[model samples]
Target: MYMRYFSRLMSAMAGPRPVVFSGPSGAGKSTLLKKLMKEYDSVFGFSVSHTTRKPRPGEQDGKDYHYVTREEMQTGIANGEFIESAVFSGNMYGTSKAAVQDVQAKNLICILDIDMQGVKNIKTTDLNPIYISIQPPSMDVLEKRLRDRKTESEESLQRRLNAAKVDMEISKEPGMFDATVINDDLEEAYQQLKQALLEEINVVKKVNMSS
Candidate 1:
């Protein structure tokens, strides 16, 4: 009976896992993650981020992102509240340990939409996360999507395009990610992501059982 109860406790503690998504700007990573969240009943959506950027129109605090002032963000960093933080294009963004803990408490899989720096930080930490790279079908599609956004000036657009090129180069390196899914077809991409997640979960479970 004691052994059985202990097994049950361990299973509960293991709970849902965590996954990380990284990609270049306009790679459709966000869209694919949203779809995966909607489709997977077991997945818990953890808003694993806080940003210094002002919320866009219709964006809600805590839901879209934990909107914080730069001063506040700096303070948090000093306090070691953030698991990882980075500055991108003059904006600060980070994932807090509290944010990840909140999801872990509920036994839900937390998904982090992060950049390369954030990914590197997570790898060094205790959270053994599976990383996935969402890739655009082609540079043409990526450029078209960025143009459609209409939120960037000519200068800003050029900067983003240049960044995207660099991001793509880094993402293609061997051993960078467990899986890479091209976001050209939504349905296909989702299926691939789902399968990759299941495989990761299974590997974790096997390790747990063996241990």
Candidate 2:
């Protein structure tokens, strides 16, 4: 009976609040997030976003995102189903309340990796989350990182750089984020992220052990 109770508790909705990660395109958010999730797989879950854009090569529905038609997304937004939604480059993208709740139901910390606009939209909602901004060491470093990828055209690269500048500025606004992690040294940045989330991490660990 106690075991059953523990199992139920582990799956309860009272788990840790969701976490929001906002940063520029080449800010090492993915690398740091990969490390954290790999280290604590059972304790973290990524909140899959919804998008009206067609899936890219190798993208899977419900995994990379919930691919929907423009009309469907529009209807969902109209009905107040999405917690935060935005239109980017002619495609609509959003984070539905259900997506976050799905992760919470599993008693894992939900991670919302979004851009600056999405961050601003979420700020207006009642869903309280710990916002963390991952920033590159400098504009030069960010440019270098993007160049290393060699995936963007000259035009696309320039666009990303411009957007990164705006994102960096927003991240600097006082009280915008709970913690701003400048990802200069990958190891040090990971350590800082862990420290910022230490309290919540401990809670999840305790629940896991008890279960």
> Which residue pairs show backbone clashes in model 2?
none
For model 2 the TM-score comes to 0.89
Task: Give candidate 1's TM-score.
Answer: 0.85
* lDDT for position 169 in model 1: 87
Ten residues in a row with the worst lDDT in model 2?
1-10
* Residue range 64-94, candidate 1, lDDT tens digits: 8999999999999887777689898799999
Runs in model 2 lying further than 4 Å from the true structure: 1-14
Candidate 2 overall lDDT versus native:
0.89
Backbone clash tally (model 1):
0
Best by lDDT: 2
Best by TM-score: 2
Error of model 2, residue 41, in angstroms: 0.8
For model 2, residues 56-169, the per-residue Cα lDDT tens digits are 789899999999999999999887677678876568999987788789888899999888999998786656789999999999999999999997788889989999999999
Local distance difference test scores for all models: 0.79, 0.89
